[model samples]
Target chain A: MSNKTITIDDIEVPFEEGQTIMDAALAAEIYIPHLCHKPGLSPHGSCKLCTVDVDGRAVSACTLPAAEGQRIDNNTPALNEVRKTITQMLFIEGNHLCPSCEKSGDCTLQAMAYHLGMLDGHFPQFYPQRELDASHPTLVLDRDRCILCELCVRASREYDGKDVFAISGRNTNRQLIVNSATGRLADSDIETDDMAAHICPVGAILIKDHGYEIPIGRRTFDLHSVAESDLGEIKLSNVRHHDE
Target chain B: MSKLRVGTTSLAGCFGCHMSFLDMDERIVGLLEHIEFTRSPINDIKHCEPCDIGLIEGGLCNADNVHVLQEFRENCKILIAVGACAINGGVPAMRNHFTLKQCLEEAFIDGIGVDNPHIPNDVEIPLLLSKVHPIHEVVKVDYYLPGCPPPADAFVKILTDLLEGREPSLPNEMLHYD
Candidate 1:
C-alpha cells in the first residue's frame, strides 16, 4: 500500500501503488456515482461513475491507477450537480419502469437516484419499441427494459469462453440481437450452458420460474441500501456471480 | 421413483454446469442411486431419447444442436434449460450484428474463412436462428434452472427439491429477477 498520500475533502489518505483514485476513495468510505463499470472487470472507463476532480480536473477514477501525493477534491457542489444531471439522463434514456422493474430495489442505477435524492427521472422517457422473447424455455429477454450497460456482453466475452454475445449499432438506435438478426434469443447460437445471460443487471434479461421465487419478505433489495452496499465488507465490484 | 433415465447435453458452452453437476461430488453417487443416466459424459454420448428429465445446457447453434434439442423435446418427459446460454441466449447471441449470408461469407467462403477449407460431408448446419433464442423458443421447458452454469448449490437445491417433491429454494443472494 506504499505510495503517495493525498488529501480529499481535507482527509489525509495513502494510496497504494496501482490502486485507482475511485478505489482509494471507496476504501475511505467515500461515495461516487458511476455506471458501465463493475469490480473484477477490465475498467471500461466507459461510464463516468467514479468521476472526481483531481486538482480541479474532472476524471474517471477506475482507469486512472494511483500515483504519489496527488491532491483530489470530490466534494464539489458543481460536481454533485453534474452527477445528478448524469443520473437523470440515464433514467430517461431507457424505459426504466422503476415501479415495475425487477431490479427496482437492487439496481445500481436506481440506488444512484436515491443517493442523489432524485425524485424523478427528470428527462423525457425514450420508449424504445422492443419485443419479448419467451421462446427460450427458461429465460426471456425484454429489450424494452435494457439500459445497455454491456455487463452481459462483457461477461460472455471474458468469463464464459463462449463469444456468443456482443453489442451492435452505434448510439441511440443500438439494440441487442441474439443469434443472427432478431431479438428472439431463441434463435441465438448461444448455448444454454454458458453463464453470460445471468450477468445482466436489468430486466432486459430475465429467468423464468425464478421471479417471485422468494417472497418480498426474503428479498435482498429491501434488506440493503445502495449506500450500505458500498460500505464495509459487503461492498463489492461485481454483484452478479462470485462473492467477494 | 422408478430408476429415472436422465440425459444431459451441452451445445455451445463453457461446460461449467456440467462441472458443477460433477461438483455435486460424492453426493452425485447418491444421485446415481436414483437416476439412470442415458446420454451423458459419465455414460456414452448418445442422442437423448425418451427420458424422465432432460437437462440441457447451452443454446442451439450449428446444425447438430437444433436436431438434438428437437430430439430431446420430443422424447423427454420434462425438459429443463440449465445455465445462462440455455436460458437467455447467453453470450454467443452477440453475432446478430451481421446477416447470416455475410457471416457465412466471412467465416467460410471469404478470405477471412479457413484458408484450405475442409469441405465437409455434412452441408446441413442447423439453420442459424434469425437471432439467438432461449431453449423454450423451440419447445416447452418444464423447468428452467438459470445461473452462470448456475451456482453448484443452486443445482443441488433444484435437484434435491425435485427429488423431495418440494419447491426448490434458490440462494438468498442469487438475483432472481433482475
Candidate 2:
C-alpha cells in the first residue's frame, strides 16, 4: 500500500495508491454519506452523494482516486445543502412511504435524510405508478421504493456472477430490470441468499414473510445511527443480526 | 399577559403525530399553564376559532382535509405542519400513483376479504381529490416539525420555543424522519 495522505475536511487520511477518496476516508473510519458506492464493488458513482471538493473542483469521492497531498473537502455547509436537495429529489421521484415502508429505520436513504437534517420532502412528489413485482416467491420487488442506485445489479453481476438484475430506462424513468425473459424476479436465478437480494439499501427488494419481525423502535437505526454503524457489514451481511 | 391560544386538528392522518404530541406526557400539563385550547380535537371544538398557533397533523388527501387546512391557515396567526404527513403527504400520498377511482375501487371492491363490497355512495363522505397533497400545498405552513411523528421531545422543544417567544427549531436528535 502506497502511504499517500489526503486531507478530508482538514483531517489527514492516508490512502493506498489505488484508493479513492471515499475508500481512504472509510478506511480511516471517517464516514462520508453514500448510497450507491459499496465496498468490494467497483465504484459506479451513480448516487453522487459522496461528492467532495478536491481543492476547488467538486468530484465524486468514490471514483476520485486519491493522490498525495490532495486537499478534499468532504463536509461543508454548501455541499450538505446540495446533498439534501438530491435526497429530496430521490424522495419526490418515487413513491416513498417511509411510515409504511418495511425498510423504515433500516433504510440507508432514510438514515441519510436524518443525518443531513432533511426534515421534510420539500419537493413536489412525482408519485409515479411504479410496478410492484411479487412474482418471486421469497422476495417482493416494489419499484416504488427503488432509488435506482443499481447496487443489486452490481452485486448480482459482480459478486454472485448471475447477472440476475440490470437497470433500464433513463432519467426520471430509469428502473431496475430482471434478467429473465418474463421480466419477473421469479423467473430469474436470484435466490434469497444472493448478494443482489441483500445489497438493496431501500425497501425495493424485501424478503417475503419477514417484515415487522423487529419492531420499529428496536431496529437498526434505532440502536445506532447509520454513520456509526458498520455500513459494509449491514449491506453485505447475509445473516439477520439484531445489531444490523 | 394572556395565555396563548392554540388550535390543533388531524386531516388525513392516522393520528400518530397527535400521539407524539400526547407523548409529551407531563410536558403537556406544564404547557397548559401558558396556553389555552381554543379549537382542537382535545376540546371537541368543530370550527377553529382565531388562535395564536395551529398545530396541523396529516396531509390533504380529500376535500374535507383541504377545507379544514384552509380554515386553520386563515384562523391561526402561524400554522405548523407537525409531522411527516403534514409536511409532505407521508403515507397517504403513497396512493398518489393511482387514480382516486382506482384507490376507492381497491378499498371498496377489488381488495381481498370482501363480502358485501359496494362503493360507498353516501353524501356524508367527502370526495377524495385527484392526488394527496402536503399542508403547504393547500396553504402556507409557517413551520415544519418532521418525523413519522416527531419524538415527544420534539413537541416539547417547539412548544417551549414558541411559548417563550422564540423561533421553533429542532435539535439534531429531534429532527428524525422515521
What is the C-alpha DockQ of each candidate? 0.01, 0.68
Give the top-scoring candidate (TM-score).
2
In the range B35-140, model 2's lDDT, one tens digit per residue, is 9998888888898889999999999988899988898889999899988788878888878878888998999899999879999989999988899888877687
For model 2, chain A alone compared with the true chain A gives a TM-score of 0.94
Worst 10 residues of 2 chain B by lDDT: B169-178
Candidate 2: the clashing residue pairs are none
- Candidate 2 DockQ score? 0.68
- Residue A197, candidate 2: Cα error in Å is 0.3
Second chain TM-score for model 2:
0.97
RMSD of candidates 1 onward, in order:
17.7, 2.4
* Tens-digit lDDT string for candidate 2 (A5-89): 8998899888887888888888888888898988888899988899889989989999988999999887799999999999988
TM-score, first chain, each model: 0.82, 0.94
Q: What is the TM-score of each candidate against the true structure?
A: 0.52, 0.93
Number of the predicted model whose lDDT against the real structure is largest: 2
Leading candidate by DockQ? 2
